[model samples]
Target: MPVAVGPYGQAQPGCFDRVKMGFMMGFAVGMAAGAMFGTFSCLRIGMRGRELMGGVGKTMMQSGGTFGTFMSIGMGIRC
Candidate 1:
């Protein structure tokens, strides 16, 4: 009778090794994906915050100009 060689060239992976390797791979992939998502989210939030701040700054400048104009008018009236 001929003996049959099992798969993996007669060197089967041990249960512990397989489990450990799987856990390591899963952790690595999860971390990579998490980092990518975190970066994307941070960039998106940063862009939005920058846009909001820019708008607020423009409004402040306009308001300041208007206030200066009013103050000038008031000074002229008092003169």
Candidate 2:
């Protein structure tokens, strides 16, 4: 649930909230980076057909998860 704002203004997000936000942002960036790199690598390796798609998909997920976890940890530390 969303937190309510007081008369003064909106309250700052908690540590967990910040971490979550960071993870989401990092995941998106990581996915895009992974997709580009994976495609290039696969093509250079002469991978075609389903192999290319599978390799790209795997790389994207792996990189996204790795980045998200690191980003979340970094954000949490600032709290």
Q: Give the TM-score of each candidate.
A: 0.42, 0.84
The number of the candidate with the highest lDDT is 2
lDDT by residue for model 2 (1-79), tens: 7866778897877878999999999899899999999999999999999999999999999899999889999998998
List CA RMSD, all candidates.
Answer: 29.6, 3.4
Could you say which candidate leads in TM-score?
A: 2
Instruction: Flag clash pairs in model 2.
Output: none
- Report model 1's TM-score to 2 decimal places: 0.42
* Whole-structure CA lDDT of model 2: 0.91
